[model samples]
Target chain A: MLTAHKIKVFQSLDKKKFRQKYNLFLVEGNKTIKEIPNSHFKIREIFSLDPSEIPTGDFDTTKITPKDLKKISFLQHPKDSVAVCELGEEKFLANLPIQIVLDGIQDPGNLGTIIRLADWFGIPQIICSEDTVDLYNPKVIQASMGSFLRVNVVYRDLVEYLTHSDAAKIGTDMDGENLYHHKFPEKFNLILGNEGNGMRPETERLLTEKITIPRFGKSTESLNVSMATGIILGQIFSHKG
Target chain B: MLTAHKIKVFQSLDKKKFRQKYNLFLVEGNKTIKEIPNSHFKIREIFSLDPSEIPTGDFDTTKITPKDLKKISFLQHPKDSVAVCELGEEKFLANLPIQIVLDGIQDPGNLGTIIRLADWFGIPQIICSEDTVDLYNPKVIQASMGSFLRVNVVYRDLVEYLTHSDAAKIGTDMDGENLYHHKFPEKFNLILGNEGNGMRPETERLLTEKITIPRFGKSTESLNVSMATGIILGQIFSHKG
Candidate 1:
């Protein structure tokens, strides 16, 4: 049975302050919760209408009523389950051929979609600037579609990281070389910027090279940052030169 | 000056039934509203805190208080302006080298992003299945970032449109030819299915070719529909033969 005080604590997880203070985050939906068993992230508790709906795991499952579940759900339509998960240990950047570096990305959905894109292209990690949206945000978790379980996301001071990394730092910019003709370095970091404003000036200064997605039409000023990331990643992973 | 009755009517446009009944929809944000003058859509009225915020246009601008604007605004944080635009004249599909076909897309943001992608790739039109989400959804208007002005989105019976068009109908699927290796026809229709469920079985039966974005990672089952559209379009429009 869920106590009134417990519901208050669960609801507070929606905000970053509470999520950080308690060292826990919320993950919803059966598909996402089912993947928890195999990941390094620990589950503190799982609330579900039916125990069978949750994957067999060591996590404690609490039976919840639909009405009570609605009180803690962050979604418009609450799913079958909501899990309170313990944050995993911070991971440092690993040496890899291709890595995605995000600078000041504000939207939770964009961050999540980029994480999923990374998973699709088999990129093992995402390095984010400290000011980027928190990975533990519930919206990011929902949008990542459980791909967060597979990809490692690390946060650091971007200037410090970019300055130290030996890999070529490639930022997306309008005046940069055409993506079609540009030769991508085998070992490089693909950097993406903010939505409304492009990359910060300090971050832009660190790029060793820049690339642009040539526009076929003049009507659109720019593609959504997450959509642009997907397109760029697809081109990078394609068999064609 | 905004009247209470008028404010009620503007707020009502948030619902599809009311928007259709009034034959008008809301487009928020200064950036989106600025694109209105060049498009076929007619602006019935513009509401903003400052008349100067409205683009120089034939439309009438009404000065509204920020407090009053909150009542009619659909966004959690409303932009500088909102335009009540009349639905444009429905345009039939024109013969084009490439077109996008969406089957039962229920998400407003996906429809909007696909429209933006079509604009980015120079794809002039998107033909949608009858059951697809309404194009005039406020969330779609917000997400498209004004690209809706450039692309034509038409809804029709999928089976009928696919059968009637002489161009090749290409559907995205897992068992299909690898996207990099697949030869895109000069004149073809790119079909994308619903998010949770794949395309309707009837819609699948009409495709002349099938292609897939090969997965490099085993963790992700699928990409978001809009992300998939962007990736596929990037390949189709690239300089590579």
Candidate 2:
């Protein structure tokens, strides 16, 4: 059973300001919550329709009815469990082989999918523009399918981040060199831009190489940013191997 | 101006049965509606907040307020125009070199993203299991980003389709041969499975080859079906190049 006050706090975590204030975010669904035990993230609390479904952990879990779960769930169809987790300490790697940079990526689903892609390809860190969707957004967390637990996503001024990095800056463009032909460096930051627009002008200026996933069909304006990330990362990592 | 009767008709297109009955589907947003002119699809009618925004074409267009568009739009944030387009004839290639086969892919967004990916890789034809989300789904159309105009998506019974096909059949799995090392034949059907459960048992039985995108990171149970599709397609096509 959840107290009225507790429900408010869980609901408040949905917003960025509250998530920042509390330094916690909600992870819903059985698949995502199940991953929490193995992840480095600290568990604050767990609310579940079936307490048995909640993974045995150090965290406190409250058994709640489906109606109660629905009240606090951001998902349309609330899952078996929802867990409140502390936003783990940001451990930015001093030097990384391949880093992903997002320039003004706005969609939560896109951001989440990219984080999952980053995890799949062993890309550890993602640097997002300050304007990118909040990492804690429920949709991002849901779409990531627990990948948010693995990838380190940090939001910063992309221009400043690019300027400070010694790594080769690569960004995708419609007219850039075909990705298949372009040999990626041992260490590089591959920047993907906004869904509607490519990289921002400031970020574009810092790019040492502009690469493109060559389009074979005439009608496709652009691949979804997440899909583009997956394709590019697959090519780069596969080629290196 | 959209009459109540017309609004009812447009809203009905949101359902798969109604879309089939009318032989038309909604194409919302300025970007998608703009693509209709260049596409092979026949436009039934165009509704726009500003009629001038509708490209000069042979189709009949009506000027409607944003509120009218919202009533008829499947999108949460309605775009300027929503055009009704005929469900154009599916031109199945008799002997295709590379084709995409979807096995019970249910998510509209995933299906849409896959269609767009197929377009990007120059895969001209997509064969979807009857259980897959309808190709005419509004969310599929929205997420495809106009790739729906170029790619041919057809629905059929997977068992029958696979049994009849002479092309080599490939499916993805966690323990299958590493995709990077697998050699794809010129004429083959690349099968992507359902989001949660991968290829159905029946479909799995049909696969001549089961390939896996080697995962470099731990804790990720699976990639989102669409991202996996993008990564696998990118590797296969790039390797051939």
Candidate 3:
């Protein structure tokens, strides 16, 4: 059973400041818990409604009732399980392959999807502008589907990262070098934009190249920002040795 | 000002049956409304707090109090305006370079993102199984941007569309051929799957060839279904044409 203090602490982790202070985040649901065993993330505390909630594990566990589960749950109905995991320490890129940098992705789900895609194509890491969504938002943790464990994601000022880094920075745009026609750079930092309006012009100015996925028909002006990440990552994976 | 009876009818659009009965759907916010102009969708009614709600056009408009907007609004806080759009008639693949079939995609957001990506790629039609989400869900409408206008999406049984259609149905899966080496067919029906699980087994059985985007590094077993669509569609668009 959870106390009011526990619920308050769980809810506070939803905020970026609290997440940063604690160096922890939470992921809920059966799918997310299952992915944790194979992920790079470390488990902190797990509270479950069912004995079978988490697959057999050595992590510290607390069996609790559904009412207890509700206190920590962000969803309308509390999930069967909840796990607090240690956020992976931020890492600097070395012998880097293709990397992804997010300028101002505000939507937590989109940010989570970006992390999941980065995990899939094996992009070395993701660097986010300070304005990016909080990694610990339960929505992001759920959306990431455990890719958060595998991908090295960090939030830092973009101007500082790009100004000092030698990696070729590619920005996606509707009108630019056709991604298909453009040569995949050996070392590149791909930048995606905000969920609504894309990269601020100042950020766009820092980009060394602007590439676009060529549109074949009369359809959407731009793909979802996360979709852009998948397209770019998949293509880069295809070209890598 | 809008009438209480009229507001009650509009609010009912939150349900599938209600949307079907009215043959109308809701479009929220100014950006979504702006995307609709020059789109294939038709505006049935426009509701906003201000007469200047929409960008201004030849449509019949109704100015409603913010209270009325809140009564029928899907958003947490009502936007300045929401438009009721005429749902397009069921469309078929008349002339298509490529088409997509969503086997059992139940999430409105995924379905919307797929439609938006298909729209950007100029893929004309999407045939969904009957159980798929209502394209009119405010969530779907919001996520699709205005691509729902350009994309012709229809709902039919899974087996029916694949059985009658001559397009080579290629389904994505784990055991399939690596997409990197898979030859692109001229006429293909690219199939995406549900979020939690991969394709339905029977759907996988009907696939001409199961295909996968190869993983370049140590990573999760698969890609998100929506991410897979972008990778495959990007390949199709980038294919030598």
Report the error of model 2 at residue A187, Å: 1.5
Listed models, DockQ each: 0.63, 0.69, 0.61
Model 2: per-residue Cα lDDT over B1-241, one tens digit each: 5789889988999898999888989998887788777878989889988888778788788998777788999989998888888998877776888889999999998999898888888888899998999999999998888898888899889999999999999999888998888888878989999998888999999999989888888745788888888888888878656
How displaced is residue A40 in candidate 1, in Å? 0.8
Pairs of residues clashing in candidate 1: none
Q: After superposition, how far is residue B195 of candidate 1 from its true place, in Å?
A: 1.4
Q: Give per-model CA RMSD.
A: 1.7, 1.8, 2.6
TM-score of model 2, chain A? 0.96
lDDT of 1 by residue, B1-241 (tens): 5788888888888688988888999888777788888888889889998879678677789888888779889899887888889987888867888989999999999998998898888778999998899888888877787888999989999999888999999999999999988889889999999999979999999999999999898565688899999999998877542
lDDT tens per residue, model 2, A1-241: 5899988988998889999998889999877888777778889889988888778888789998889999899999998988889988877775898989999999998998888888877788899999999999999998888899889998889899899999999999888998989988988999999999888898999999999887776754778788888888889878655
TM-score of each model, paired residue for residue: 0.96, 0.95, 0.91
Better of 1 and 2 by lDDT: 1
- Considering the two chains of model 3, state its CAPRI-style docking category: medium
Best-performing candidate as measured by DockQ: 2
Cα error, residue B144 of model 1, in Å, equals 1.3
Clashes by residue pair, model 2? none
Number of clashing residue pairs in every model?
0, 0, 1
